[model samples]
Target: MIKIVEVESNKDLKSFIDFPHELYKSDPNYVPALYMSEKHLLTKHPFHHHSEMSLFLAYKNGKIAGRIAAILNVNYNTFHKDSVGFFGFFESTNDFNVAEKLFEVAEKWLKAKKAVKIIGPVNPSTNESCGYLVEGKNEPPVVMMPYNQPYYHDLFLKMGFHKNTDLLAYLIDVGSFQDKSVKMLDLLSQRLSKRGIIVRKVNLKYFKKEIAECMTVYNEAWDKNLGFVPMTDEEFEQMANDAKMILDPDFCLVAEYEGKAIGFTLCIPDINQIQIKMKKGRLFPFGIFKLLLGRKKIKKLRVLALGVKEEYRRVGIEAVLYGTLLKNAREKGIVEAEASWILEENQMMNRALENLNGHMYKRYRIVEKAIL
Candidate 1:
């Protein structure tokens, strides 16, 4: 018998967070998320200010079988003017019944919230981790990217979910990126300078000011993306605070025009490299040593974000950002990078990355179904 239980207590929440650690224990490429971080995201993240979500666990014969979170993103609905709910934090055993029950619970919850259509696997929202791994199951995911068994795609489809949009993850070898692109960087940057746009690393001395500028660029640059909802000041600040720990100033770049921020790219070390060895995602009792000792040994980074103002597009700022980051990465001995979660429809950015020899190694999809 399968029983569906809502997570209401700390004990249940802990089980909800820890289930995947046990579920994927035998899978070599599964990286366990930090328990503390998952806790905060579920219970206290700023998304809660404008959204309501419920977490549920499925148990069969007294053992946990699956988990899911049904989210009503009020902000997303208001911004897009669509009553779309989302399903995220999904995990289940191979049994079709368990998966169906989980989605049924999610659907029921969303319908009660007045959602007309359901779309996701967004782990809450696109602002955080989203998508299901439909391709590229060979290696572990890069930082802040989703990874799961190949069967997940089938599971969603079996439940009548259809493709919403496919997201692309491109891998760039730091040692072998297009030399022509590298060679033209200095020239292009110089040309951009003539237009009053200069490319430079983010200044840590004015960290807060730089972050504010980044927020501006981020909100403007990504506003047009599918399923994107502008981050409130609180949400951006909260995310920035968490990202500050692993941020490499060299990999963070900003494009300025006459002293005004126009574009930016933020990359962080692929911390999953360290987390993979952290033994169930703990940072104490020697996990701390493993983390600190392994930070410098990390060899890859994820271009977590890159964006330019609408008027600033096609002026070579994007190439400069990529070039500066790649050059700095090679100098620092990093050999692998992934520019991930790019929308498939973003042809210009996709072409730019492909021009730099970025290979589309992984593909993730957000699935949707009309609920009304």
Candidate 2:
């Protein structure tokens, strides 16, 4: 019998967290997320303030078949007023029956909440990890990104899901991108300097204070995005603390207007390049040694997030951010980087990247289906 059980105990919760590891154990491209970190994300992350979610596991013939989470964000509905629900943390054996049963559980839970539309594979929400990894299947994901079996796409399509949005990931070889874009950047930046706009690496001494300024701009910058949810001070602080561990000050750049922060770009070394090699996703005993030793050898990065406050959207801040990123990459010996999860509709950011000669090497999509 295939039975779906709500996670009601510690043992069941552990199984839910460990399911993906077991399912992807044989896949070399699969990277295990840090156990402690995922636990907190699902359990104690401050996102719970505006959202409610529940977890479920599918068992078939006494074997773990799949897992999923049903999510309802009161804030999301109120903002867009779309009555949309989300399903995330999804994983399953390569079986149509198993996937249907898992998705049914998510659908049922959403229906109970009066959600009229269902969307995602969005771990919990877009404010965190979101999307189904539909392309670039040959390698593991960047740090804090999602990855899954290629066949999973067919599973969702069969389950009546269709594309709600697509996110693009751009790849740029550091030495090559800098070489190609440098001259134009140099010329343009000089133009920008004459207008009093300056590009520079972040100052660490007042990092926290700067983050506060950026936070105000962040909410304004992305306010027009689909499913956009502004972060609370607590949530931003927590996320910043986590990023501080691996955040390269050089790779995080800001654009100033008369000494005020108008835009920022942040990237981090793709630590998953090392994390996946660790196999078990631990940072102890041998894992810590591997992480420390492997950091320098890994040469890829992810341009994680970027924003230009609404008042300063056009003009040339994006190029300034990219130019500053170029300087950082040259200094750090980074060979390549991925600027990702760009919404297909975000033509503004897309044009900025293309102008820098970034190629859309990978694509991911969020799918949706209506139950009624």
Candidate 3:
């Protein structure tokens, strides 16, 4: 027999966070999320200011069999003008009944909140990690991306979730990319310079100001993407603060024209290389030392965010950002990089990545089902 329980106590929540570790113990590619970070995102993040969520766990024979989060994102609804709820942080056993019961509880919770439809795998929002791995399960996920058992897709489909859209992740070899545009980097930079545009490493000293401008570009650039809703000021800043910890200025580049920030790209070291070694994603009892020192051993990078303001699009600024990151990654001895979670419909950016020989190695899907 299976029982579904709402996560109410801190103990239950810990188990909720830790369940995946046990679930994927034998899966070599599973990278456990940092326990503390997951806790903060669940309990204290500013996302809670505009959304409500409840975590549920499915137990069989008194052992955790699965878990899910049912979310009512007020901000998303207000922006999209739809009564859509979201489900995320989902993990489960291969048991169909367990998965069904978990979704049933999530649907019930969202129905109470008047969410007419349920959509996701977005831990809580599009601003954070979302989607389930439907392709490329052979490798571990880069930092801040989702990875799941191959059965996850089947579970959702069997539960009546249909495809909403897919997110793409491309892998680039830092040491030897096609680099068809490598020769054009200089020409692109010069042309932009003629227009009073300059590409430079972000100024950590002026982080607050720089990040604010980047957020402006971010909101405008991604405004048209499917399911995108502009992140509130507080949400962007809170996320920036966390990124600041691991940011290397060289990997965070910005393009400005006449001192107006218009385009930027953020690539961070793949700390998952370090986190994977940390037992249970804990950063204590020597894990901290490994994290700090192991960073130098990190040879992979994830192009977490890249965007150009609408007016700046098609002006070679995008190529310049990639070129800059490529050069920096090589200098740092980075061997691999991934430009990820691009919408499948984003032809221009997808083509640009493909031009540089970025192979689409991973695909993530976000699905939906009517609440009824």
Model 3, span 339-362: residue lDDT tens: 987999999889988988889999
Error of 3 at 271 (Å): 0.7
Q: What lDDT does model 1 reach?
A: 0.90
**lDDT (C-alpha, whole model) for all candidates:** 0.90, 0.84, 0.90
Q: Which runs in model 1 stand beyond 4 Å of their true positions?
A: none
List the candidate numbers ranked by lDDT, top first: 3, 1, 2
Write model 2 residue lDDT over 239-271, tens digit each, in one string.
777887888788888888899888888888888
Q: TM per model?
A: 0.98, 0.95, 0.98
Instruction: Tell me the spans in candidate 2 whose CA falls farther than 4 Å from its real position.
Output: 178-181, 184-187
Sum up the clashes in candidate 3.
0
Per-candidate alpha-carbon RMSD to the true structure: 1.0, 1.8, 1.1
- Candidate closer to the true structure by lDDT (higher is better), 2 or 3: 3
Clashing pairs in 2: none
